[model samples]
Target: MPEHGHKTPHLQEHLLNIPVPDYAPELRQLVFDYTLQLADTSLILGHRLSEWCGHGPILEQDLAMANIALDLIGETRSLYQYAATLEGKGRTEDDLAYLRSAVEYKNPLLVEQPNGDFGDTVMRQFLFDGFHYFLLKALKHSSDQGLSAIAAKSFKEASYHIKWSSEWVIRLGDGTEESKHRMEKAVGNLWMYSGELFMMTDTEKQLLEAGILPDYTSIKQQWDEHVAKVFSEATLEVPQQVYMQQGGKMGKHSEHLGYILTELQYLQRTYPGLEW
Candidate 1:
């Protein structure tokens, strides 16, 4: 395995040194909320992936999933650092990540859902990865330079995640009958949570008006096409249900987020100010 230590300094420099653009208080607050949404989603999903660390069906897949988890957590750190700076509240990334209650987190509910099985995990990842690819692609052109920089870095990893997850979706859907059944079941279970990805909040609306964020209306169309193509290839039926779940953007979350925070915040809550 490669030593990740050599990369730490560079990562820290990028996270700590990104220039924050001067904007109105309202705009800054909107951007801060948007950054928290991004960070929370990444952190929650990364935590889900990390749960697969030693339990993967194969050794190669275990390591690959773990590495992907690391990439997501690293991206989450950068986003949290930027959000802390934007808040101008003397809050560190650790505070934003570890000290917040579930109600304060803005991650989409899809990310907080339990990882039922390998099939469930892959489907969840595929849906999010598809949405994230388009989101990061548009964010790369954000008016906020710091956010754009973070988006640029995150897009590369999102691309890999999309590819990996999409392939697994196809492989399972088109493989053995048992695999296909499980994959299909996973897809059905997750379809409702997927809609929250494109649900724009008031903060996002303001950011859209200010050109700090992309119009998700168009992004949703692109996402639909991308998902449709992948689902067709996977021989999976796309759920046509229009009753999409929402509220995560507004900080209302599913019960699962509470459990996630309990485990995630344990070390920080138990040993305040502790660090390596």
Candidate 2:
């Protein structure tokens, strides 16, 4: 029997059984919260990256970034699909992605930050991609089959994302003196926000203990090593800033996400569940 009274018809036939462990209500809430945030993060970031479809610094880079954007979007769809299942709602992935307000979104502010220049975009991606790679590595063993499968596939994709973003980081950081300076500033600007990626709440603790997920702290070490190596190769200095923005995990987003959501949700809101 499915635990927690959660029926997973479409999922059960395709996945192995993963029994839910004993946990307090708060811990379960945390799991749901974390999962929601993960999905929202991918969705919002994918949308932002898609903005660069034709505006890349070069045709090759433009295409590369666009390809990455497509992957993120695809990943976002998978995540939201699973999240809807977890929520036990009939809502489709499109409903969650297109209809949510900014305050309802759980994506970190870093991914939504403006893309100032090629260096800035690469720097943002470098930081986020590094963290994503590490997170997916741990998620590959999740007790939740839907979540685990998504992470397993995403892990492979993230390898490429890490490679692609890291290459750009190095190219801009070590290319021209101007490029290096810009890349350095981008890193500094984005550094403060990196801490949020590894912050653990009670939900994560429970998941880790249940052998459903890996500890974020353990993954942090690997993330740091990978990021440091890339920055070293790029000839960029990592910033030492400690003060950073927060509240993304709690559905508090920057002002930009509102505008973006407005644009994205316009047709959906006006049409009220109309589909082609």
Best by TM-score: 1
Query: lDDT tens string, model 2, 225-262?
Result: 98889889988776664787877766677788888888
Off by over 4 Å in 2: 1-30
* Cα lDDT, model 2, residue 132: 93
- Estimate the lDDT of model 2: 0.78
**For model 1, how does the per-residue alpha-carbon lDDT over 1-276 read when each residue is reduced to its tens digit?**
558655445555546478877988888888999999999999999999999999999999998889889889988999999999898889999999999998899998899999899999999999999889999999999879988999899899999999999999999998999999999899888999999999888888889999889999888999899889988998999888558999887889988999999999999999999988
Global Cα lDDT for candidate 1? 0.90
Give the alpha-carbon lDDT of every model.
0.90, 0.78
Please identify model 1 stretches exceeding 4 Å from their true place: 1-16
